[model samples]
Target: METTFVGRHVEIAQVARLMRESRLVTLTGLGGVGKSRLAHRVVEESVAEFPDGLWLVELACLTDPHLLPETVADVMGLADQPARRRAEVLAEWLGPRRSLLVLDTCEHLVEAVASLVDTLLRAAPRLRVLVTGRQPLGAPGEHVYSVPPLPVEDAVALLRERAGLAAPPDGSGGEGGAAELAELCQGLDRIPLAIELAAVQLRTLPPTVLLRRLNDRYHLLTGDGGPVRHGSLRAAMGWSHELCTPAERLLWARLSVFASGFDLEAAEYVCAGGPLPAGQVLEALTGLADKSLLQREEHPTGVRLRMLDTVREFGAEWLSRLGEDSAVRGRHRDHYLRLARRCATEWPGRQVEWYGRIRAERRNLRKVFELCLADPQWSRAGLDLAGTLWFLWVCCGMSREGRHHLETALRADPGPGPERLRALWVCAWVAALQGDLAAARERLDQCRAEDPEGSVTGHVLQVEGMLALLRRDHARAVELLEEAMAWHMAKGGVLSGLLPCHALAALGLLAAGRPAEAVETLSEGQALCEVHGEEWSRAQMEYVFAWAGHVEGEASGALRHARSALASALGFEDLSLSAACVEMIAWAVTEEGDAGGGAWLLGVAQAVRDSLGLPRSGSGIFAPVREQTLTQAVKVLGGAGFDTLFAEGQGSDLGIAVKYALGEKIS
Candidate 1:
C-alpha cells in the first residue's frame, strides 16, 4: 500500500456509478483482493458530492460485533451523550445530513453490519454506506460489486512498481521481458496482494527463482485451496511468512493482539519476552516491515506499525496454534489499563493533548472496555476504568458513549464498593446532562443505596444540584449546591469535581436569581483553579460569572468575562461550554445595543449546538434570551435583513466567528 496505486480505475468508476443509484454498496472479493483500497479510492473520487463529508470506519480493528454502531458513531464524531441506543443516536444525528460512510473489513461481522445498515438506512434516508468484505452484507437495496484481481497488464505493472525494478532478469527490457512479467503475474494468479508479496522476494531472489518458488507453493496449496484465487494469495503469504525470521514471526503473532495500529512502546511491552526477547522486538518489527508483512506509519507522537488484515489473520491463526491468545490478550488489557490511569492523571494539566491522545487510542480502549465488561473476573476493573474516564465522556462531548460503557459495567457487577459507588454518580451526572431526569435520579438513588456511608458525598451532592437546576427548582438547587461546595471545601476537592463544585453552585445561584452571591462563590473557585494551574474548571467558573453579570444587568462587564471564558473554551475545545459562552455574548451584545450583532451570535450558537447535538445550558437558564434577542433583531432590522445576517453567522467558520466576537481583526 505504500507504493503508488497501479490499477482499479474501471472498478472505481463502476463503484462510483453504483453509489449514485444506490444507498448501500458492497465491494466483495477474495482475501487480499484490494476491496478496502478500492473502497477508499471510490470515496476519494466522489467525496465532494456529499456535504456532510466522508467517514471511513475501519471494522477490522473491532473485536466485538456489538460495537458496530458505536464504532460508526465514533468515526462520525457524533457525541453519543443521549441515553438512547447508539444506533438511534447515529440515526438522529445523520438523518438530515448528506454523508458517505465507508465501513471497511466486514467479513467477520456481516450479520451485525447488515443489521446496523438496515436500521440506519431506514432512519437516515440521506445516508449512504460503502462496505468492503469478502462477501455481501445482503441488506435491502444493497448493490454488490465484486472486486476483481488485477488483470494481466495492471498486475505486471503493479509487480514491477512494487519491486522498483526497471526490468526482470528473465525479461531484459523487451518482448521477452513483457512475456516474462505477464507469465509471472499469471503464476501468482494476478491478485494484487499475491503480486505484491511476490514483488518483495525479488529483493533477494531473481524473477525466475521467485516464479519457480511461487509455482511450487501454489501447487502444494492446490490440495486444500482447490484452484481458487485464494490459493494463489495464500501461497504468496506463506512464502512471505517463511521469509520472516522466527523472532519476527513470533512478534507478528503477538502484535495481532493490538486492535489498531500501535506505537513501538506498546509492541515492545506486549509482544516481548519468552523466546522472542524484550530487547529484540524492534529488530523483529523492522524485519517484518522490510518483508512487507507489516507497515510503518510516521505520526507526530512517534512511529506506529500495523499489519494488513490478511497478514494479521495469518498471525492470529499462528497465535491460536501457539495457545498464547489468552496470555497476549491479558497483557494487552493490562497495558491499556495502566495507560488509561496515566491519561486520567495527565488530563488535569494536558487537557488539549489528552483529547488527542485518547481519540488516537479510542478503538483500542473500546476493545479493552468490552473485554473487561464481558468477563466477570475483570468487571471491577471495568467499573473503575469507566468511572475514571468521566472527563473524556463528559468534557469531550461523548457523554452518550461514556454512559454506554458505564451502563455495561454497572450491569456486569452489582455490589457494594467505592468503584461502583463512583460509577453510579458519574452515570447520573451524564444522564442529567442529557435531560434524563428519571434515569439520573435512579442512578443517584443507586449511588446512595450502595454507599450508605457516603464516600462520594460531594459527587452525589453536585449531581443532585445539577439535576435540580435543570428542572428549574432554583431554591432546592441552591441549597444542595451549597452543601456540595461546603463538602468540597472541607475534604479538599478531587479532579473535575473539587473546583467544579464552585461553578455548579454558581449556576444554581444564578438560576435562583442571586447573581451577587454567585460572584462571591466563583471568585474563590477561580482562585483555586489558578493555584492548581487548571483552566477547564476556571473557564466554567468564568462562563458562570459572565452569565451572572448579564443577569444583574451589567452588559459590558459580562461581555468582558464571557470573552475571557470563550478564549479558554476554544483552547480546551469543549463544544457545549463554547456554545454557552457564545450564547452569553449574544445576550451581552443585545443589551449593549447591537441587535444585529446579537442576531449573528445567536445563529452561530445555534449552529454549534446543532453540529454537536448539545442541549441548552442548565436545561434552559438562558433559553429565554434566544427568543428575546431574535424578536428584538427582527423589530430593528426587519425579517429579511435579520435572516441574511443570521445566515452569515451560520455559514462562517467557528474560529472566525469567535475572533469576530472577540473584536479581533478578521483577515
Candidate 2:
C-alpha cells in the first residue's frame, strides 16, 4: 500500500465485480504479471463489506503442503490448539464471520489450497477467498480471471513514474519518448516486475540506449526455462544480474537461503562469507535494493529486505549453479539454531519481545526445522530446537505445531542422547496437553528408560502431575507436583522447570478446594517471576491467582488479577491463558452484578476457545465452572437477552473483543 500503484483500473474493477458475484476468485497469470499486487489493491478497496477481518497469506515461503493450515493460522494471528484439526478449528471460528481471505502465490500448492479454501467457504458462508497464482486452483464454482499483462501505455507510465525518483524522463526520443518507452515495455512483455527492474536502469541508461540494450538482453537469455510470456522477466532479471557487482550477485544468491525476507543481521550472518565478506554484505544488499532486486520493508524494529518470488527463483537457480546451496543452507541452519538458543536463554525476561521475534521468524524457523529433520547430521539440532522451544509450544498457542515438529524430529533421529530425551519429554508434555494421555505416558516412559542419568526426572514428574490434574485426581496431582518441585530443588533449581511446577501445583491446590494453600503456593512463583522479570510464566501464575480468588468469592481480587494476566497473556500470544483469564474476568464481572458485561465476556471466551479448539482433551476440567458462569449470566440477563449479548461478543473480531475485555469503551 505504501508504493505508488500504476494503472490497473480495468483489472481492478473486474476482480472486484467477480468478488461480489463469487465467494472464491482466482487471478491467474505469468510469474511477473502483478496478480498479487492487484489482489492487494482490490482487497483494500473492497474491505468495507468484510467487517470481520481481511487476511493475506503469502504461500511462496511455504514448501510443505502440511504447514498450509498452520501458516494460514499464523497469518490470522492464531496459535492453534493441539489435537483439534487446524482446519476444523479455523472453520469453527470463521463459521459466523464475514472475512476476506487472500492467498497469494499459491501456484505451488494448488490442490492443498483448493481443499482448504473449499472447507472454509463451505463452513464460513459469509467468508470470501481471493487467490492469486500462476494458474487457477480449479475449485468448484471458482471464478478464474486470467490477468493480462499491463497495457503498453500503462507500463510506460509505470516505468516513467518509477524512473522519476532519480531524474525526469527524457522527452526527446520519437514523439515525446512514447515510441521508445512503449518499445521497452513491449520488449519486457509489459510485466510490471520486469518493467520496474528495467525502469531503475533509466537513472543510468538513456531511453534509446535502454531499448537497444533490451534487444541484446533478450538474445542473451534465449531458450531459458519458463513460459514465453515470462521471458521479459527472465531477461530483465538476467540483465540486472549482469549489471550488479560480483558482491551483489553472490549476496543475492546466498540470501535465497532465507525462506522469507530477513533483517540486516540475518543477511550479514547468513549471506556473508567467502567472496562477499561480512563487512561488504550491507553495501551489496544496498546495491541490490537500489536495483529493485530486493524490496525494503520498514518495520518498527528495522528495515526488512525481500526479493520477489520470480527474482528469488532466479537467485536460487544461480545458487545451485554456483554449487553453494547446501553450504548456504547449513549456514542458515546454524544461524537460526544460535538464534533459538539465544531466544531460550534470554527468555528469562523480555517474554513479550521474544514472542514478537519468534512470530516474525516463524516461516524461517519452519524452514530450518524441516531442513534439520530431513538431514541426519541436523537431526539432533532439530530435536534440540523443538525441545528448547517448549515455551512456544506449551505456553504459547502452538502446542499442535510443536507436537508435530517434535514428533517428526523424534522419529527422524532416534537414539539415546540428551536431545532425544528432551524431545521425548516435550513431546509427552504436548501430548498430555492435547489429551493424548496414552501417547503422553508412552513418551514419558521412554524418557525414563532412555535417560539413564535421569536428568529429566523433574520434567517427568511435572508432566505426570499435569496428567493427574487433567484426570481430576487433585490430591495425587498435588503430591506429584510437590515431588517435582522437590526434585527441581534438589537438582539445584531448574528455574525454568520450577515456574510451571509452581503454577501447576497452585492449580492442584485450587482444584482440591484448598484456595488458601493455592494463594500461598502462588506467592512463591510470583516472587520467582519477579526476580527473573518473567512475564509469560508469571501470567500463568496470575491466572491461577485469579482462579483462586474467584473460587474464594473475592470477585474484585479476581478481576484485578485476571486483568493483569490477560494483558501479559495476550502480549505473549498465549490464547489458552487468555481464555482462562477472560473466563475468570467474566466470572468476577457476573459476581459483581454486571451480568450483561459478564455474559458478553463469557461469549468472547467461548468463541476464542472454540477457535482454539479448546475444552478438548486436556482442558475440559473447567467445564463445570464455565457452566455455572453461563447460568448466572442467563439468570441476570434472561436467556434471550443473554444470547443477544453473547452473540454480539462472539461475532466481534478478536481485536475488538480483546480491547473491550481490556476495559476499552465499546458498544
Candidate 3:
C-alpha cells in the first residue's frame, strides 16, 4: 500500500476525520477519480494505528457475490468458512481486530457490501471500514465523502505528464483548443477514468478533432496508449468483456436483465438457460469479475452482485447485438413465473425458504412483473407473478411491493373473469394484510360487483374471511371462514389452503379467544403442510402455535415455537414471518415477566415492519401485534415506557429491522 497521493488532499483529511469519528467511512466518487488511490493512501498512512495489519478485499476481481465474505475471510486467513454465509464469519473475525478494512469498488455490489459493512460495524468495535464506490453505501453512522476529479490546471498537468506530450503553443493555432479540451474534460463528469482516457487520443489526434469525435464516438475518443491497452473508460469495459469466454459472455449478456442487483442462485437459474451450466456459473462469474466486468460483495445474510453503469451499458449493447434480449427476458419471466407459482403453492409452510427466495429474486422479479404488465401477450405472466407473490405481500411481509405490481397489472386490464377475479382476491388480500380494511372492502366489492357468479367466488370468500380476522371481525370472519371451508369441501378441497386455515385459526384462537382450539387447528395445518411438503406453510403453522401458546400462558412453549418459526422465516427470507415471529417473541417475553425484553423485541418488529414499508393501517399483523404487545408490556412494566418503538426503526431505505419488540424509528 502506497501512502503517496497526487490529488484529493482535502478528501484525504476529511475522510480520515470521518473514520476517527465513525466506525464506517464511505468514500464515494465517480470511477477512477483517485478513490482507490486515495483509499490506498489513507490505509497506508493510518496503518500504524491498527496493530493488526490492514485487510484489503479488492472487489474488482470478485464476481460471485456469495464468495465475497469468504474471500475476505481467506485474506484474513480464517479457516472453516461456510459457503452459504460469510458475513457471520467476517463479523466474528473482526470482532476483536483493531484494523483497517478497505472495501474497494463496491458500487456494483451495493446491497451485499452494505450488509457486510453493517454486520462488521455491529460486531467489531475496533474495526474500521474504508469503502470506495460511486455512491454512499447508505449504512448507519456512515460518514460519506464524495471525491471530485482533479482541477483543470491539475488535469492538464497530469495529462501532459501521463501522455508525455509538450504543452500546446501559446494562443492562436490549436492552443485555445487545448484549453477548450481541458474544459471538455471537466464536463465529462470530472471522472479521472474519463480524463485519462481522453488524454490517450492526444498522441494521434489534434485536440479539437479529438473533442469533436468524442461526442459521436465515445468508444474511440475514450482510448489512449496502444490498441492492446486502450486505457479508455469505454475501452476498460470493452477490454474486460473481451477477456470473457463464450460462456461467460453469454452469462454477461443475460445478466443485463437485472436493472438493480441480484444473487448467484438467480444468475444460475435465469442466466444459465442452456448457455452455461449451473455448476460452472460461479466460475464464469469469477472470470467476469477477474476482467472487472462484474463485482461481488457480501450482504448480512446473503450475497448481492452487480455491474458498473458503463459495464452494464456495454453489456446492454452486447445483448442487443445478440438479439437475445427478448428471449432472455422471456426466460427470466418464465423462471420467476414458475418460481412464483411454486412458492405460492407452497406458501405459509416453508416460510424460511419462501422469504429467502423472495428476498433473492425480489429486484429482478419486479422487472419481470413490469414486462408482463407492459405487454398484453405477457399480462398473464404478470398476473401470475403478482398472484403468486401475494403471500409474499401479506403473510411473508411484502405487501407494499405486491400491492404496487398488482394494482399496475389490474389497471392495465381490469376485467373480472376467473383469472382476473383471482387477481382481485390477491389484491384484496394485500390490502387486508396492510390493515386497510377499507381498501380490502373496496377491492372485494369491486370483485363481487364485476363477477356475481364467477368461479373464483369461493377464493374471494376465503380472502373475505381472512380479512375479517385481520380486522378483528371474529363473528363475520368465522362465518366467512366456515362458508369458504364448506365451499372447499364441496369443490374437493381446492381453495381451503394455508390462508383460509390460518384465517380460521387466527379467528378461532385470537379474536374469538379460543386458544386451545386455535392450537388444535394450527396443529392440523402443520400436519397438512408436512404431508404436502410445504415447509413455508408449516412455518406459518408454527407461528400460529407460538401465538396461541403465548395467549395460553405457556410462555416457554411459545418462545420455543417462535424460535423455530424465525429460523424457518430466515431460511425463506420471509419478511412477514420474521416480523410475525419477532412480534410473537415480544408477546412471550411480556408473558414471561420480561417487560424490558419484550420492549426490545417490539422494537425489532417495528424495524422489520418499517423496512418492508408495511402500511401503518393500525390493523395489520404488525400493528395488531405491536399494539397488543405494547399493551401487555405496559401491564408488565407499569407503562409502555417513554421510548417510541416505531420511531427508532427508520434507518434508511434499506429498512433493516433495528429491534424486534419496541418498533423504534431509526434515523
Candidate 4:
C-alpha cells in the first residue's frame, strides 16, 4: 500500500529522474525532514519500471550490523541455504531479476549497508538501490540527493491537509488566517514534520493563539546576542517543547520510555508521579498531542499516541537532564510488567481483546524485557514478564522471539526463585514449539526441581505432558495431563494452566485412538471456555474436537467444529490454528464426498504453514490426519485432477481460502 504523500511532487520527480539515471540514489536529510517519505514516493512512482518488484528493508529497529545481509535476504523471501553465505544467497537470488531495493534509516548502519549494497550492485547488474539517511552511503557511483524542507506555500498546503482545515475563504477577509499559518510554518523552518505537528493544534487551539505561543517562546529563548537557529528543526521542536505546561513536558519525557506507541492509561500509569499527578494525565496528554509532540493514531482497539523518533530523542535528552531516567524507567518496566500479567490473567475470558492489546504493546514489552535483563536488580522482573507472555509467543507463531527473550532472561537471572521457575517452564514451552526436545526437557527438569510442591508444579507437569505428547508417549502424556488438570481444578481458582491442561489432555486421548473420550473431554473444555469467554484455548480445543469427530466418522459434526475453530483462529490472526482448522475442514469435506474441495483446502493449509516457515512436522498432532486426507483426496480425484485443484487452492489468498472453507464456491 502507498503511504499518503503531500507536498513532495518536485522532490518526487527529481528523485525518480535520478533513480532512472543512476543505479544508486541516496536521499540525505536531517531527522524528520521527510527523506523517507520522498524515497517512498519515488519508489511508488517508479515501481512499474521494475517488473521483478520493489522491496523495503527497514533498519530503524535493526541494531546489529552483522545481520544486515540476513535481514535483506529475509525481507526478499530468500531462505538460507546450507553452507552458502547469506550475501551470496542474496546476490544469486537478485541476479537476473530487475528490482528496486529501498534501504531505509541507514545512518546508524551506513558502513554495513554500503558494503552490502556495493556487493549486490556489482553482482546483480539489474538491481537499483535507493537509500534514506542523514548522510550518503559513500559507495562508488552513488548519486546523492539532499532533500530540503517544504517550500512555504507547499508547507501551508500540507498543514491544511493534515489538520483537516480548509484554506481561509478566498475573499472573506480571512487573510489573517493565511498569514498566521505561513508564520507558523516559517517558525518551524518549513519542515514538513514540524509544520504538521504545529498544524494539528488547530483542532484545539486557534491558529492565532498557537502562533502567539510560538512567538513568545522564541522571543524568550532567543535573547540578545544568541545566533538564531531558525533553520534548525531541533530548535523549532525545543521551542514547541518549551510552550508546554510542566505536566505536559514531564509526560512527554516519560512517554519516551516506550519503544512504540501507548494509550492514555499506560501514560498515566508510567508518567504520573510527584510533579505530574495521575488526575491531570489525560489533559496533559491532549496538550502534548495538540502541540504535535505526540501523534494520535486511531486503531481498531483504541486511540494510541506515538512520538516521532526525533521528538522521542529530544524527550529522552530532557529526561536524562531531569535525572529521573532510572525512576521513570522503573515505572515503565512496572507498567508493562503489570500489563503482561493482566493479559495473562484476562486471556482466559477475553482472548481476542487481550491478543490485540498484547500485539499493540509488543514493542513496549520488548523494551521492558530489555530493561529488566540489562539491570541486575530488574532481571527477575524481566524473567517474570517473559514467563507471563508464553501463550502469546507459543500459540501466536512467535516462538522464535519468545525463545530469544526467555533465554536471555534466564541467562541474566539464573538464581533460584519462583520467577526463575516460571521462566523455565515458559522457555520449555517455546523450545518444544521449535522442536528442540532436549532444551524442553532440560527446562522442564529445572522447573520441576525448583518448584516441586508449589503452585507452579501444575504448570511444570503440563509442560512435561506436552513434551511427552511431542515424543509420542501417549499413556505418559495422558497421565501427566490428567494429574495437572486435577491439581489446578482442585486449587479452585481460574488457573491459566487449566486451559493448556485441557488442550493437551484432549490431544493425548486422541493420540491414544480414544476418539469418543477425546471428543467428550474437549467438549467440556469448550463449554468452560465459553463460560469464561476464553477464545484462544477454546479455538484449539475446537480443532481437537473436529479431529475427534473425524476419527469417529462423523463428517457433519467434524465440519461444524472445524468451522467454529476457524472463525476464532482468523479473528485472532493465529496462523497455526488457522492452518490446523483448514486441514481438518479439508478432511471433513473429503469425507462429505467433495474430493476436489478437500484437495484445494489441503493446498491452502500447506501455503499457510509455508508462509510461517513451519515444517510439516510442526503440526505434530495433526500430521496423521493431514497425511490421510491427502491420500484419500488423491485416490478419489486421481493425480491430474488433484494437482489442478491443489494448485487452485495454493493460488488463493487467505480471504478466498476462508470463504472456500466456509462452503462458498470460488470462481
Candidate 5:
C-alpha cells in the first residue's frame, strides 16, 4: 500500500493503537484537518486482518435525523430490511465476523449514531467501529483520537506539494517577510486546509505579497486554522469563505437559512433576495461546488446541495454581518409556508405523489419554524406551518420537533380564533404521541372546556383514541374513535379528515383482532389517499395489511404486503411503518419453517434498526407470528451457530420465498 500521509504519522498510529485495544475508535476533529483522510488511510492499512471487509458509511449527505441508520444499511447494500429495523441484522452479520465499520462525518446524527454504536458493540464482540466527526460518539470503551493540524514545517511542505512548488530559498526574502508569512500561516493554525488554500494563491502571488495582504487585520487572510467546534468542522470553513468571489460570498451568506440540503428551487426562493438574482443562484452554487465549499449530490428526489458545518457557520456569520439574516429568513419562512399550504391542499388528493417530496422538504419547514418563532410577528405564520404539518408530526412520528414548534407558537401570542384551535389540537395530538397521557388529556380537556362541540375537540378525540389504541386500551380506543367519528360527521367536517378513517381502522383492527377486516376498512381510506394522493394513508393502510396477514398465519403473504408498504414508508420516510414491515417480513420468513431464512431476515431487520438507531415492538400482527416462526427456525438453523448459517448464506432466497408466497415478482 502507498502510505501517502503528508504529516499525520502520530495521529495515524494513535488511531491504529486505539483500534487494536478498543472496540470503538472515534477520530473527532474539525473539517479539513484530515480526520477523514487519516481514518481512511488507517482502515486501508489495517483492514487485511479482518475476515469481513471494511465498510465505510459517510453521513455527510444525511439530512434526515430519523433515517441515519437506514442510510447506513443502504450503504451496506441491505434494502430489504425496513426502516429502523436493521440493527439486529447488522449486529448478526458482524457478530461473528471480524470487521471494521468506518462511519464518516456523523455530527448531524449524533443521537442515532450513539444508539447504533452502542447496540453493535453489545452484539458483536469482535467488530470495531471507527468514526470521524467533530464530536465523539460517546459510547463505552470509546477511544477518542483528536486530530490536530499539521506542524508548521510539515504543513508548509504539504502546501508546497499541493501548490506544485519547490521549497523557498533560505533568507530569500529581505527583512521579516518569511517570518511574516509563517506567522500568518501559524495564526491560521498551520492547518492543512489553510496551508493548501494559501498554497493555491502561491501560483500567482508570492508568499511575501500574500503575507502583506494578509497583514491587514480586517480582511480575512486565506490562512485560517481548522478547528472542531460544537463537534463540527467550523474553523477550517472560514478559510474557504475567505477565498470566495463577491457574488459567491453573498449567496453563501443567504444560503445559511436552510436547515438541511436543498434543491435549486429553494436556493432561488430564499437565497435570491437582494443583490443575488434567481438566475445567479445556480451559478453561485456551482462556484461554491467548484471551490469545494458546497457538496453536490444526486438524491433520489433531485440533485441536492449541502454545506459543511464549519462552512455553514461562516456563511451564517457573514449573513449576520451583512444584516441579511432577517430578510432571508423571511423569504425562507414565506417559501415553506407556501409549500405547506400547497402540500395541505393537495394532501386530500392523488397529488399524494408529492408526500415523500414534501417529507423531504421538512428541513426547510424546521427552518421556517425557527424564523417564525424568532419574530413574534410571524407567529401566525408559524401557526399555519405547525397546523398544516399536524398529520406529519402526529401520524408520521415527528412529534419531537412538531410538539416543540407547537408549544413555541402557542406561547408566541397568536390571536385567539379558529387557527388557535388548530394549534391547540396539534399540541394535544403531539402530547399524546409523546406518551404524555396526562398532558394529552389535560390539553384535550382544555380544548373541550373552551368549546366542547368545536372542531378542535374532534381532533382531540381522534388523538385520544389513537393514543388509546397505542396503549392497548382497545375499549377506550373504540369509544374515543366512535365519539370522534360522530363529532366530525355532525359537523360535516372534511378538514381534519384522515383522522376519522385512521381511528376507524385502528379501533376496528385492535378491537376485532381481525387484521384482514382492518385491512378492508383501511382500504376505504386508500381511495381518499388516491383522491388526495397522500402517502401517509398508503403507509397506514400497508401497516393494516401487514398486521392482518401476520395475524392470519399467512407469513408469506404478510411479507409481500410489508414490501408493498415500503414504498409508502419510504415516501414519508416513516420509521414506524418501516419497522412494522420489516418485523412482518422476518416473522413471515420464519413461519415458512425456514430457520436459515428467518435468521437472515432477523439479521436484515436488525441491520435496519441499527441504521435507524432505535428499537421496535414485535407485539403487532407480524411481530408475534415472526417470533413464533423464528423460534422454530432458530432451532433448525442452530448447528454450529446462527452466524455460521448467515455467513453460509443458506437461507431460502427472498426472491424464491416471494414467488412461492405472493405469486408475483418482488420489487
Candidate 6:
C-alpha cells in the first residue's frame, strides 16, 4: 500500500517552477511514461503555495464531454442550480479564489477540458491549472512539458527498490543482480510503469530468468526498427502479456470490454466462458494483477480492477487478432444490458441504490450502446437497451444523451418489432422533455404505425397523454392516460405500463382543474406502487398530490407532500420533479400568507430550472399557478423586499432551498 515515487525529483522541481511562471501547465507524454505520477509529485510539492488549496479532478472515468463542467462543479462542491449555466457558475465561484486545479487524463476530453480551462483562465485571474495527458491542451499562453522516461540509473534504482522488497532477501543483491536489472530497464525503454511492472516479477522470477524471458519476447515482437519509445513499451507489454498463463491472457483481453474499472463479480460474469471457465476467473484475474497487467484498487463496494488505457489497447488488439473480439463484445453488451434491465426493474423499490448502480456503470452502458448500434445485427438489441434505460435518461437528467443514443439506434434500425416500438415511445418521451412536441408526436406516430395493438400501445398512449398535457389539452390528456392505465392493468406483464400510466394520469387530472380527482388518482398510483414496492414514479405522483392539496386549501398537507416529493426526487437526482415540488411548496407558503418565503422558494425553483438547462415555457400545467404565486408574493412582500428575497434564494445552496421549502428557518 506504500507507493513511493521514484527518481522524478528534477522533473518535479522543473514542473513546479514552470507552473509558478505559467497560468496553465500541461504535462504531456506517452502513456505509461509517468506523466500522471510526475504531475502528482509536482502538485504535492506546490499545493501549499495556493491559499485556496489544490484540487484534483480525475477525468479517467468521465465519458461524456457535455458533463465536464458539471463534474468539475460537483468536485468543487458547487450545488446544482437550474437558473444558470454550470460553467458560468463555476467561473464565478473560482474567480476570486487563488487555487490550482489539476485535471488528470484529459486526452479523451481534450477539447472540453481545453475550452473549460480557457474560460476559467479568462475569468479567474488568480487561478492556475495543471493538466496531465498524452497531448497538450494547446490553449493560449499554455506551457507544455514533455515528460521523458527515466534515465538508466534511475530506472535501475526504481526496479531495485521494487524488486528488493518483493524478492527474497537472501536471493537478491549482487553485481550480477544489478546488471540484470539494468538490462531489463533498458529493454523496457526506462518507462517507469513498465519498469515497475517488470520489477514485480522478481517476486516469482530471478533477475536472470526474467531478463532472459523478456529478451526472447522482445525478439519475437520487435520489427522494422520502430521508434525506441514505442517499440520498447510495446515489447515490454508483450513480454508481460506472454508471461501470463493462457487463462490469464484470455481474461486480460476480455477485460478490455469494460470502459472503466469493474469488480471481480463483473469480470467473472462478462469474461468467463470457453477456455476460461467461470471457476478460474478469480485466479486468472489475480495472476494478471500480480503481473501488473491489471491495476487493483479498493472501493467502497469491493476491490476493483482497472487496465491502463495503453495496456487495454494492447489486449484489445490481441483480442481482435484471436477473432474473439465480437464474441467477447457480445458478452459485454449482454452483461450491461442485463444490468440496465435490473436497474430499471428494481428502481421503483430501491430508488437510491439503483440510481447509484446505474450511475456507476454509465460508461459501460455507453460502450454497450455504441457496440450494439455499430452493428446492424445488434441494432434491435441496442434499441431495446436504450428504451429500457428511459428512466435513467428522463428522470435522472440525461435527456440529451438519451436522445442521442435513441435517435442513433432508431435511424440505424428501422425494422419493426416490439423493441423498435418501445424505442419509439422512449424517444418520444425524451423529445417531450426537450420541448420538441413535433418530434415527440412524430415518434409516437411511428410507434402507432409499428404496432397499435402490441404491448407498447399502453406506453405510446401514455406518451401521447404527456404531449397533450404539455400542450394544455388537459381533458384529452386525462382520457388518454386513463385508457393507457386500464390497458396496462389488463395486460399485467413484465413490461407493464402501470407506473407511467398512473403518474401521467394524475398529472392530467390535476392539469384539468380537478384537484379532488387528481388526489384520488395519485392515491391509487401510490397504493399500486406500495403494493409493488416501486418508487420511481411515486416521486412524480407525490408532486401532483402536493399540488392537489394546495388547490383544495390544505396548506399544511400540501407542504408535507411537497417536502416528501422533493426528498424523493433529490434522492433520485430527478431535477425537474424537484423543481416542481419547490414551486408547489412556494404556492402553499404564499397561500399561507408567508409571501417572503414564497418568493424566495419561487426564486430557488427558477435557479434549479436554470441549472438544469431547461427553458421557461409560457404554457404548461403549472405556468398559470406560478404566475399567480409570483404576483401575489410581489404584492405582499413589495418590489424591494421581493428582489432581496429572490437574490438570497438565487445564491442559496440547493439543500438550503429544500430546508426552507419545508419551513425550516435559515441560519
**Winning model by lDDT:** 2
lDDT of 4: 0.78
Q: How high is each candidate's TM-score? A: 0.91, 0.95, 0.62, 0.81, 0.69, 0.83
TM-score: which candidate is best? 2
Quickly count the clashes in candidate 6: 11
Candidate 2: 10-residue stretch with minimal lDDT: 166-175
What is the lDDT, from 0 to 100, of the residue 583 in candidate 3? 74
lDDT of 4 by residue, 1-667 (tens): 1125777788888888898899999999888889877887777788799987589987665555655775575466432222124465566556666889999889989999999998889888999999999899999989999999898888888877777776677722343377777877887778877776665556557777766677665665465555643434655576567668989888888988887789988989999999888999999998887776777888777999888777887788779979999999998888888888888877766777877888777668777877777789888888888888877776664565677778888999889887888788888877776667788899988887777567677777788888889888988999999988888888753446787688889989988988777868887887787788777788788888887787888889889999998988777667677888889899999999998889999888876665555565445677877888889999998999999998778656568789889777878
Q: What is the lDDT of residue 334 in candidate 5?
A: 82
Query: Sort by TM-score, best first: what order?
Result: 2, 1, 6, 4, 5, 3
Task: Give the TM-score (vs. native) of candidate 4.
Answer: 0.81
Name the runs in model 5 displaced over 4 angstroms: 1-10, 22-32, 36-146, 151-189, 199-208, 217-245, 347-384, 394-420, 423-443, 467-496, 499-503, 506-523, 542-562, 582-667
Q: Point out where model 1 deviates above 4 Å.
A: 64-67, 83-98, 115-127, 167-176, 215-229, 570-573, 592-594, 611-618, 639-667
Candidate 2 vs candidate 3: the lDDT winner is 2
Evaluate all candidate structures by whole-model CA lDDT and list the values in order: 0.81, 0.85, 0.65, 0.78, 0.66, 0.79
Assess the local accuracy of residue 89 in candidate 6 as a C-alpha lDDT between 0 and 100: 59
User: How far is 245's C-alpha from truth in model 2 (Å)?
Assistant: 1.6
The stretch of ten residues in a row with the least summed lDDT in candidate 1 is 611-620
Once fitted onto the true fold, the runs of candidate 4 whose alpha carbons sit more than 4 angstroms away are 1-5, 16-26, 39-131, 135-146, 151-190, 195-231, 452-455, 492-495, 664-667
Candidate 3: count of backbone clashes, pairs at least 3 residues apart or interchain:
56
Model 1's TM-score against the true structure: 0.91
- Which 10 consecutive positions of candidate 6 have the poorest summed lDDT? 77-86
Least accurate 10 contiguous residues by lDDT in model 3: 646-655
> TM-score of predicted model 2?
0.95
lDDT of 6 at 288: 89
Tell me which residue pairs clash in candidate 4: none
Instruction: Kindly list the per-residue Cα lDDT of model 1 for residues 1-667, writing each as its tens digit.
Output: 3667788888888999999999999999888888988888888788899976589999887877766776786667544446356676567656666888999999899999998898888998889999999889889999999998888888888887887767546555632377777888888778888888888886667777766787677676565543454778878887887888899889988988888889887888889979987899889988888888888887656677888888887788778779999999899998888888888888766777777767677778888988898799999999998998888777776776788888989999997788899899999998876678899999999888878787788889999988788777888888988888788778876565778778888888887778778889899888887777677788888888887877777889888988898888776557677777887788788888898898898888876666555563324655765666688788888999889888777656666898878878989
Task: Put down candidate 6 lDDT per residue, 298-408, tens digits, no spaces.
Answer: 754457789887788788877987899988888888888888888777765676777776777767887888788778888888999988888777777667667877888
